[model samples]
Target: MLKLFFRHKWGPALLILLLAALVFFYNLGDISLWDPDEPRGAVIAHEMLQRGDWIHLSYNGHPVTDNPALVKPPLYYWSIALFSALQGHVDEFSARLPSALAGITTAILVFFLGARIFGTKTGFLGGLIFISNHMLFEQARSAEIDMTLTFLITAALFLFYHCYHEHYRPGWLYPAYAALGLAVLAKGPVGVIVPLMIAFLYLLARRDLKAIGKIKLPAGLLIILAVASPWFILEGRAFGAEFFFRQNFERFFHAFDHIQPWYYYFVKLPIHFLPWTLLLPAAVAYWFRRRKEKNPGRTFLLIWFIATFVFFSLSQSKRSLYIVPLYPALSLLVAEALERISSEQNLASLLPWIRGGAAFFALLLVTAGGTAAWLAATRFHDLARPVALLVAAALAGAALLYRMIRKGEGRGIVTAFLVCAFGLELLMAGVVYPSIDVKSRSS
Candidate 1:
């Protein structure tokens, strides 16, 4: 069975899409729209439909008088409104469908990007890691701009990386620019800025200054302007500089909301990254050890992750999801690290730490499961069934992870970890989140 799957050309990608669909789409509408952001996005999309105005964003059918609705661009709302129109009403599933589809598409993009940079197996692992993580899955299930923005950014980077490797093919760069344009349409300048920064940083790291000319900045900028400028131009004509200067630029330098210390992302990133975070330290060490070598894949990925991390950390306004675009880099890095570590040559050196990390993660799952089960049994009887399902999945997966590591099944070890993590995510989606959603509303 495994041999047949390995031989098939489309097998890994199909598997990834299937798993992503299962996790992202399951119980999608079972919960109500989350307060604040989710409902804000859904309502704006709903109003867009009702008023038949695709350009001007509003809430509750009233024109947004504050500042031209600059908090987020209209693309995401446009997506939601389209989905809602298809479904004949604005419900949670339609509102959130774009994000879910983005998440799935991003997973497939990771597969191709990883394959191009790393190898086929590593690409497969990267795709699985992309979707199974806490941050991606959670965002995929929500009606928010971040996931959509993340997809656009990832798509742009993937195209950029393609152009980079294909000797800066002029034709390939156009789609990348278009993606960035849509990204800007989705969330504003940050979308364009983030990809450009990463590309510039990657080139700088490579010491390939001359390659900059081949990127055709003039043509690319025109494409971006052609796709992105129309909306911004109209927006400026209507509302002037307040939306552009204040909402896009000023918020970064001096945040009026969600202000946090510089180290905010440093603390939350680990929780957001979840099970994969356990292997991150070793992955960083692995890259550092190979830093002197001429490895563009690792070099680009390291810069991609670190540069984005520093960028978000430096922002005066901070949110954990702001850094979602960088998560794909981490996934690819971890996948490459695992591929290397799973080999017999490196397995002995890294196996102990990997085993310990696995054991500790499993212990966390067991503990969290037990606590949730106890709470469900005592204080929240409504959550009893879901809690039992979560606990059972956790316990069973934890045991499997421990056993797989204990047996020292090198390649199987990586497979085991992915399976266990994916199972946990499935249970979390199908049972845990909906249960908590119900409990929260009742409380």
Candidate 2:
């Protein structure tokens, strides 16, 4: 069983998703939903199902469009509604299951794209890094649109990458078109806009900006309009063109919600990337140090990462999850860097950076564990010992891994490090989450 799990083609992906599920759904229903976003979304789906009006969405019998803050499109809500049917009710588990699956499938797509462009090893490493991304893990379990949007956008971008290079396969653009439409439905125009921007910049850098023409623009646009237009058309007739302005444009340009400084992502990205953040210095040095190199896949990812960073940095409304859409590209870049470093002889020179990343992670694990216990002490004091024990186990695991790296076990370094990451993530999901949930309720 162990050998087959290791050697089978699709087996690793299932194992990785299984890890993600442990981190996502272990205590999914043990805690109540986060206010405003989670409860609001769950309630909206429940109300929509009760009303049997798929086209129109209502929260507590009120039109979601009536509330500017709640102005999300139908794709996420509809998904939650449909999935909630299994239990004949709406709640965290069912409402959030699609998001969890989307996160899993997004990792699989990363594997395919990476394998197509790089090699199987790079693809597998990249997929592992993505699924273990701290922010992705957090969002995967939550009932929200960001993971769903990130999945759709990543899918569209992956399709475009293939369609651009293999123009003979114009057929790929059809599903890419469908993904873009779903992206728009998932978030808004920005969903479509981010992909378009990425494609434009990537091609421009390649001196083949006209490759967009090969995407079967007429058919692609028709497909997008066909898939995306029906909902908007129904929405327009039901509510007028106000859906466009209120959701997309106003959120982009106006000063109403989630306003943050231009450097918001710059500040938040490190936290979002977490364990992968260690490879960042090497990733940047690898990319820009050989900037003019003709590695199409790496170049595309660099452009995607930079473009996403700058684009979201400049947005008037900035949230950490806005950059969540960019994490796959970031993960691939880190994987590429690690892969490159591993193949080099003097990997010892990079040890300082690796140790630095390890130190940061140790601090994070220690802090997360301590914080969870401290906070829970006031309300759920009984939960504190278990939380402290979990943190100790994580720290012990991390120490053993770091000791191996220090003792020249380079091969196990990456594997050992990733195990610690997985352990910390699982610890958070399984043990610490209930404490945090308790704290959130009190405050």
lDDT tens readout by residue for model 1, 309-415: 99888889898989999999999998887777777485457766677667777888799889988998888887788888888888987888788878975566667
Off by over 4 Å in 2: 1-9, 237-240, 346-348, 363-380, 438-443
Tell me model 2's lDDT, rounded to 2 decimals. 0.78
TM-score of each: 0.95, 0.92
> Local error of candidate 2 at 258, Å?
0.8
lDDT of 2 by residue, 1-443 (tens): 64455454477666666766677667777778877688888898898888889888887788877776777788988998888987899887887888888988888888878777777667778888998878988888888899999999899899889877885488877998899988888887888888889988988988986777777878987888888889877876544456577555776788578999888888899877877786577666666656777899988888888998898887798889888888889888888777766666655466556556666666666676667667667666767666677868766876766676576543456676678877777777766777777767777
CA lDDT, every model vs. true structure: 0.83, 0.78
Residue-pair clashes per candidate: 0, 0
